[model samples]
Target chain A: AQSVAQPEDQVNVAEGNPLTVKCTYSVSGNPYLFWYVQYPNRGLQFLLKYITGDNLVKGSYGFEAEFNKSQTSFHLKKPSALVSDSALYFCAVRAYDSNYQLIWGAGTKLIIKP
Target chain B: NAGVTQTPKFRILKIGQSMTLQCTQDMNHNYMYWYRQDPGMGLKLIYYSVGAGITDKGEVPNGYNVSRSTTEDFPLRLELAAPSQTSVYFCASSDRGSNQPQHFGDGTRLSIL
Candidate 1:
């Protein structure tokens, strides 16, 4: 079974500071990891994804994620955070060989404070 | 273009009542999915269809049923409304190939009382 775990319930970062949302996963074969953001009363928007090759993947809104096979983690990172970046972040995974079903993590609330 | 569309942005149903949540997509995606998001919780997959006429159960399919009769439409049926089933339902669609991110609808807020 493919699953993702977001250890932190919330992450607070100062405006213009670097932000990080942690995620780890367990799956069979290679994993396809994804990051999505949900603003208040809005549907989820795709941030980025890591399939194969390049450990670092850049996505929308200047967000990026690094895939660490050894740690089974794909942590979302942003070099500079803004108040508008405050939203719910979700980490999801899909097994390369299994049926196409995205397994989602509990999600982490990101609060960018001034 | 409208990526995905869900009807009845808000709905209230009494216990034991049944309703179908409608979903449609315009991207001609071969994969469509149904998910429910609870407050402060991650979205749980209710069901998915690879293509028209082929549907499968997801992690949380109990109390729910889905049918994909066409490439652009997939409707989810709740046989008996329950408080536990009250949540925001999202409809999404994606291409058949891997790594193709799914596009989501605004979502339907269903309330069971």
Candidate 2:
């Protein structure tokens, strides 16, 4: 079964500090990973995706994610966090056998304290 | 470009009432999906359509129905509202396939009492 896990329910980071939201996956074959961010009362915005490219993928709003194939992980990262970066983060992997279905992670709340 | 649009941003429904959550995408996406996000939980897919007149059930589709009559419109129908159905509903669309990033609407907040 293909599944995505966001181990941490919440992550706290101070403003201007580096932040990381961990995500790991279990899949049968090479996976397509994606990251999305959701602000309060808003829909998710696409951050970045790893189809078949460099290990480090850059996305919107100065956010980036590293796809570690060996670790089966795709962790969202930012060199310098801001107060406005506080939001919910989700990780997903495309189902190997399904048409357009994605296995989504439970989500991680990122809190950036100023 | 109005990427994806969902109607009735917020709603409250009584038990046994039925309602339709409308979704439309101007991107002419080939794939459309309906997902419900409950508090503290990840999204659960209710239905999806690959194209016009091609709808299929997803992970949790017991109490809901969906129709894709055209390339741009995919609406989710709740036959009988239930307390358990209270959730934030998100409608998304992708141009090519799962590998492509999905575009989402603002989402509809529905509460069933």
Candidate 3:
């Protein structure tokens, strides 16, 4: 079965500090991984996706993720954390052969303290 | 471009009442989906449509129905409201292809009492 896991339910970081949100997946074959961010009372916004390119993928709002095939991980990272960056983050994965079905992680709440 | 729009941004319903949540996309996307989000959890897919007149069940399709009559409209129907159904519903659309990002609506907040 294809599944995604976000080990941390919540992560705290001080403003201006580097932040990392961990994610891992278990799939049968090569996986299409994605990250999304949701603000309060709003729908989720696409952050980045790793399809079949460079392992390090850059996305909106200065966010990025590194896809590691060996470890089956795709962790979201940012050089500096901002108060506005605090939100809910989700990791999703889909096996290349799956019929457009995405397996989503529980989600991680990121808190950036100023 | 009004990517994806959902109606009744907020709604309250009494038990046994029925209602439909409206969703439409102007992008002419071939794929549309309905998902429910609880207070502190990830989204659960309820239904999805690949194109007009074609709809299928998703991860959690119980207690709900959906219809895709046209390329742009996909509405979710609840036959009888229940307290457990109280959740924020999101509608999303994606073009015809893999790896394409889905566009989402602001979401509809529904509370069943």
Best by DockQ: 2
Tens-place lDDT per residue, model 1, A1-114, is 567899999999999999999999999989989999999877899999998999999999999999999999999999999999999999999888868888899899999999
- Badly placed stretches (over 4 Å) of model 2 are none
User: lDDT order of candidates, best first?
Assistant: 1, 2, 3
Q: What is candidate 3's CA lDDT for residue A17?
A: 100
lDDT of 3 by residue, A33-108 (tens): 9999999888889999999979999999999999999999999999999999999999999788877877889999
Residue pairs whose backbone atoms clash in candidate 2: none
Q: List, residue by residue over B31-64, the lDDT tens digit for candidate 2.
A: 9999999977888899999999999989999999
**B-chain TM-scores per prediction:** 0.98, 0.97, 0.98
DockQ scores of the candidates: 0.75, 0.81, 0.72
Which residue pairs in candidate 1 collide?
none
Better of 2 and 3 by DockQ: 2
Model 1 residue B103 CA deviation in Å: 0.8
lDDT-wise, the better of 1 and 3 is: 1
Could you tell me the lDDT of residue B106 within candidate 2? 94
C-alpha lDDT of candidate 1 relative to the true structure: 0.94
User: iRMS of candidate 3, one decimal?
Assistant: 1.1
